[model samples]
Target: MSTETKEKYEKYYVPEQSPWPIVGAIGLFLLAFGGGNFIQQTTGKYGNEGSWGWLIFLVGLSIILYMMWSWWRDTVRESMGGLYSSQMDRSFRQGMLWFITSEVMFFAAFFGGLFYARTMVMPWLGGEGNNAMTHALLWPEFIPSWPMVETPAGDTTTAMGAFGLPAINTAILLTSSWTLTIAHHALIKGNRNTLINYTVITALLGVIFLCLQAYEYYEAYHHMGLTLGSGIYGSTFFMLTGFHGLHVTIGTIFLIVLSIRCASGHFKPENHFAFEAGAWYWHFVDVVWLFLFIFVYIL
Candidate 1:
């Protein structure tokens, strides 16, 4: 290589091959497989009567935790060692941008399915245009509806309302976003205690939100007859909110880590992309919940 190119390559910090990526992938796969099986068993799927799904899920979660600890340790060490340059900073920003973009698309697919079901599939099944004969011959009693409380097979469920727990959770998330912004501003001003305090509060708010949601789920299953198996409406409602809740859980952990790092005096006013990244992720999660509130709950 030319001397200039060789010098440029050497100037940028690139770590050696890491095992963490593969480890994380395995962890994610196991989490998905086990979680799916666990749900099936919970719902009384006969073949999984003696399944080890919950155990596998726990193992996967433990591996993921270990991977995060090790990976973050190495990255923090490298950063503290002054190995990353402006180029690396830009790379980090770009990587986060793309990651969030992919997440947007992931949720987009679910929203698309929701839209298609509501507008096209439901209408067609209810005797719209070309499917009139099919509807007449088949589901003649079926009603074109938004909530789809009754399944074609005769299972019924009550639709969750937009008020009460959902509205309270929305307020909590919005307030948490505001507090996180205040924390970011405090970090910029080098108010370490304020940063840590607000960050902890944000994480606590996330925990409360999860707790309330769990209660809501209990009410749905026991009183409202709403469940994962409760026809299309229940499935869509749970799928969207459940996935968003998982994101909130991850974002809460991210904020908690940032809080610990802030307490350790790990970031300076001018150099704190990790804090900014956590804020970005939290805001993204908050925005997704807004959409869920509008489309999945209110609508």
Candidate 2:
């Protein structure tokens, strides 16, 4: 290309081949396999042992953490080195948007299942409409309910209420979202100290939310008898909340890393896509939790 042509068109920086993608894929496979085994073992589904499952799961988790740190570190280095251009920034934003869209679809599937179970399966089993014969052959005494606490095989459990821990968690997440917004505003206004303070607070709020969720799970398993084996209700409940908790954990780590970078004098007012991406993710998480609170808990 001619010098003038080359000068007119900015070149995108293409990094060397990286090993993180395959490493991340392997880690995800291990995590999914081990997690499946662990669930089966805990529920006595296939007589599998839980210990090995836990081990593999933790190993996978560690590998994933390492992969994320290394990959993100490289990205940060590239960003700080001024290798990224406006086109690259747009690419990053688009990537994050698509990522969040995938996440939305993921949660939508779960919510769809919940809807199908409630509207179709539960009512059919309860002998509603023309399904009386089907109900007789299946679960004769099954009652159509919003929170089905009894299994067909006579396993009974309590439904979680929206008044306690769930409500508190909702408040916590909302507050964190507000704090994060403040932090973002502060960053834009060049108020570094306020930015750091609110960001830290948001991270702490996420940790607190996770801790409370853990306690809620403990209570569910122990006191309420609400377990993975407690029929479709239990399965759906745990699946929705557990996956959401995992997202919160990841978002918390995202915020924590951003905060650390902030403290290290990274991210400027004009060029801070990393911070913006993190905020976008956290806001998405908060919205998902709101839906969970409403449909899964209150309604």
Candidate 3:
């Protein structure tokens, strides 16, 4: 082998096979099955004892959490011990980028659903195109409007106007993205303390955004009388916004992990796939929330 090839292969350190992935898969399976059962029970399609399903789902979630911590802990140990090579770093970067792209597609599906409901389905139902008689028979009072101020079933919710909390959250998320970027810069410059400080600030902003979102949901559901079961309008509203909230939750966890890694001196100025991966995921999340704010809340 050439000297370069020999060095590359020699430098790379692949760990032995581990059992965490399989355990994580089982945890996910349990969560999925239990969640399905719980939802069915909530909608009265299943027996009243669906609390068992929820209990099982929580157990699965706990298991998954434990698995993630253990698996990542092992990975971090290997990384800090200087086991990864340039090729390994490239692989990690590519994988994280692809994962973020998949998340983009996931959010895109929800956005597409919102657009179709507003522009096509509701309009067709209001006699805008070929279904006049059907429209008259179904919902004579149905009006097609963007932001969906009213539903055919008479459940009305004031659109979450974009002025107060939503706008504040937008600013918060945008600032968090900037803070994370600063942290990344600090990491690259080997400013460990500065990097840690910026990362913690970014994570705190994420927590603040989540808190605001919780209050927003409460205001929508309780005061505005808008709920998941309200109608198609409410269903689409909750589904799109709710899933985005879940993504935010995951991104927060990602940042928290990054902060811990940074504090532990796990990353260096030259090589830090773990830090980059967390930053990529966080930026992806920030972009998705921007779209949600504009399309779901503002527009």
Q: Provide the overall lDDT of each model, using Cα atoms, as 2-decimal numbers.
A: 0.92, 0.94, 0.83
lDDT of 3 by residue, 93-166 (tens): 88888878888888878889888888888888889868898789998877777767665656577667788899
- Candidate RMSDs in Å, in order, are 2.4, 1.2, 2.5
* Model 2 residue 146 CA deviation in Å: 1.8
Best by lDDT: 2
Q: Pick the candidate with the highest TM-score.
A: 2
Q: What range of 10 consecutive residues in model 2 has the weakest lDDT sum?
A: 42-51
Q: What TM value does model 2 have?
A: 0.97
Rank list by TM-score: 2, 1, 3
Error of 1 at 208 (Å): 0.9
Candidate 2's residue-wise lDDT over 60-178, tens digit each? Answer: 99999999999999999999999999889999999999999999999999999999999999898989899999999998777798899888789899999999999999999999999
Mark the regions of model 1 whose C-alpha exceeds 4 Å error after superposition.
1-10, 44-50
Higher-TM-score candidate of 1 and 3: 1
Residue pairs in collision within model 3:
none
